[model samples]
Target: MKLFLVTKVVPFIMQLFVRFIYISSKKVFHHPKIDSKEPFIVAFWHGELLMQPFNYKRIRPKGKVSAMISEHKDGEAITRTVEYLGIDSIRGSSTRGGAKALIGAIKELKAGYDIAITPDGPKGPRHSVADGIVAISQKTNARILIFNCRPTKYWQFNSWDKFIVPKPFGKLEFFIQEPLDISSLEQKEAKELIQDKMLLNAMK
Candidate 1:
């Protein structure tokens, strides 16, 4: 029963819920000038993951999008959910299957797909940026696009990242910063810049 719910039932329900909330709400965007054809290493905090598929659609409707998801059970539900929403899921994370995931993400970006990564995810030191994403950006020579959102009304979970889901029928603001090219910087310097940008746009 639990397996069935995680693999099938949860994703189905969550998809319906996400669609209703997003369709009913007013969306506002603060986007930079974007080139629809270039791939990006799209970074956002883990807590803000819920609305990103739709957000990505608005920003780059024709661009392909993929996300790195952990191989855990909770991630199973999320994987199915995002796939349902038209984004591909690369199964791995920092603690498990890290190498394979990194390679997969690099390939995706080189193939012209925008790969979304949660700088802090699959468990946390909550909002801290991880080096894996920066390394991927460097290896693929793709710029990191920082994205985040805030909803006028919501529920905040007591998880490590204080995960939030916007209440139905509210306003949602999607924020996007200009892409950061870290290929020329030292790894430490690049990681710090990504962290600073993520922290600056973090939802309240």
Candidate 2:
């Protein structure tokens, strides 16, 4: 019953929540490489995912955006949220059915849809980059576009990922860093760089 309610209702609630964010907070985008409409890997920490479902329409309004979501109950709920909001989701997680997810992401990218990733998700140490994003970028030869959001006042959950929810009405600022090519960097280095760009200050 709980799963059914969550899967059915949360999507609508989340849509309203996203709208509240849009109306309550200020938004800004800094995409330096707008000349190229090439598909890239979009990443952010899992905690900051609350209002991300609105980002595609806010940033690339007409471009295709698909996310790599975990294959779990929570993921299923989130998949519904994204789908309801008009973003596509491919379900799989690092610990479960990951290989299939990677292939799906690659195919999506190849077909011109940008792939969104929570590098340290499906369980996280918070703000760390997992191996999946790096591996997917290297395999598909797609650049990783890391982004971040800092809200003036918000709710921070005590979950493993330190999940955050910005207060209904607050100042929210988003930063989009320039795309970083993973095909050129070693796996470990690529992961570190992606983590640093997402966690540390990459762009203001």
Candidate 3:
């Protein structure tokens, strides 16, 4: 009964919270390509996860979006939370079933589904990028669109990733970096640059 409530009821509450975020947000979208029908990867950090599903809906309401979630209990709850916003989640993470996550993302990308990944997520050293995301981008040949969202007014949780929740009627400065072609950069270089950029923006 407790587990059921956590999975079902908690996600319901979270969906409501996300709804509040959407309606209250003062949004600025930087990339015109995102407004198009072409599918791309949105590499976002774990801390700013609350806004991603809504971001997808706001940008291209009908475009398919998918992302990897963990196989853990907390992940199960979050998977449900995101599903409420109409995004599908696959169970896997870098520490567990990482390969499965990559395979799933690749399949979705090939099918032309826009995918998002929190490189420092599901547990984090905060703003760090795991190589799996880089691999997925390389395999899919999808340009990576980096997300840099900074809450102008918000609450920061005492979580490992210092999770953020924007205050009601507050603005969030969301800057989408120019799309990066993974084929042009070495794997390590690409991951490092992404991690650096995300960390820099989060600290801003």
Residue pairs with colliding backbones in model 1 are none
lDDT of 1 by residue, 1-204 (tens): 998988899999999999999999999999999877889988999999999888788888777888999987779999999988999989899988889999999999888888999979989889887789988988988998898889999999999999999998999999899989999999889888888888786875
Could you tell me the lDDT of residue 137 within candidate 1? Answer: 88
Candidate 1: list runs displaced more than 4 Å.
Answer: none
Question: Per-residue lDDT for 163 in model 3?
Answer: 86
Off by over 4 Å in 3: 34-37
Question: What does the lDDT read for residue 158 in candidate 2?
Answer: 79
What is the TM-score of each predicted model, taking all chains together?
0.97, 0.92, 0.92
lDDT of 1 at 83: 86
State the local distance difference test value for candidate 2. Answer: 0.79
Any residue pairs clashing in model 2, and if so which? none
Which wins on TM-score, candidate 2 or candidate 3? 2
Best by lDDT: 1
Pairs of residues clashing in candidate 3: none
